[model samples]
Target: MTRYVMVADLRRCVGCQTCTAACKHANATPPGVQWRRVLDMEIGEYPDVRRAFVPVGCMHCADPPCMEVCPSTATRQRDDGIVTIDYDLCIGCAYCAVACPYQARYKVETPRFAYGEAPTESEAQRHEAGRIGVSTKCTFCVDRIDSGVEQGLTPGEDPEATPACVNSCIAKALHFGDLDDPDSNVSQLLAENQHFRMHEELGTGPGFYYLWDRA
Candidate 1:
């Protein structure tokens, strides 16, 4: 029952977006396909305004709604407690996406960017050939994890093996490790913080938790 958890210290986060870049590079994600997204929420009146940035991806819920509602049975919980989906089984129905409280899934027929300069036809042809027909999301680097675990690399190891997000955090605000181990960093953080999981009222029982800044 070795389950890994991701812990973010909001108090330490400076919104550098290094994690976002790491995720993108590690996952080879295309435009409009982000496994990690930074959302900014504004609070207070215009005169006394303040902002908060929340980086969100898949919560990888314990009782994943996506798993429950996928008509094709494309999504399910792995033995390691990660939720996974089979794109070849998905029919672009968006059922699982709708079922996810976090809106964690998306289908893609063509992947392209809307921002910055567009890719050249040669680059488009190359990427499209690699991933023109597939469903995508934050796998938490499932392929990488599988490969890394085989080679004995931990989730926080960087440069050559750790997950993209964990390695790329400029502020070092993110931690990932076995939640089942009391001695693990993730476990230690949870013990010290008044942590909260997103949409806990939704009852998805997400494995992911957040250590928030004092409001």
Candidate 2:
């Protein structure tokens, strides 16, 4: 079984929103529906303060609460551990939104454009008609992953198969790979780093891991 995960190295993250921009451009998510975002965190006090830029998005948990609460059965987790939303089945009741501890889900009721009323050709091209009035979140670039794999490419290692955010990471803070593979990049990093997952107590088994230490 294949399991995809993302590892974020805090040391290399410079709080640059390049990943966020790349996500927006690639997904063409509506205004205020950020599938991927970097949270600027400041720790300690005054002179001893430390800044950390943590990227946050759909963790694609092993135990997905969103999928559980979806009354319409719109949310489902793929065999590869990618969580996806079926827009046709979704009722946009926001049940998944309320159930999510990560706050990864979004309900876009109205459409908005970059230039107010009229949308540009590029915006229109990227827009998904199926996403409107539906619960939306990150898909871990599943389309790219599937296509890449079919073409004999490794998703987490290949730039074309990886998530846009990971590919756009200027500092190489983000890493995507198969956690199930012992020799995978993500597995090696997790094995060597002092890492933690957000809200693990909730038992989400979030695929996203944060590495605070180099060794």
lDDT of each: 0.74, 0.92
Clashing residue pairs, backbone N/CA/C < 3 A, model 1 = none
Ten contiguous residues minimizing lDDT sum, candidate 1: 122-131
Worst 10 residues of 2 by lDDT: 123-132
Residues 1-215, candidate 1, lDDT per residue (tens digit)?
78866788776777777888878767666767778876767889979997766678888888888889888887878877788877667666777778888876766676575454676555454454334554557877777778887787765444344567877788777877778888877888888887899999999988777788442
Q: Which candidate wins on lDDT?
A: 2
Per-prediction RMSD in angstroms? 2.9, 1.0
Please list the residue runs of candidate 2 whose C-alpha ends up more than 4 Å from where it truly belongs after superposition. none
Over the stretch 20-50, how does candidate 2's per-residue lDDT look in tens digits? 9999888889788899999999999999998
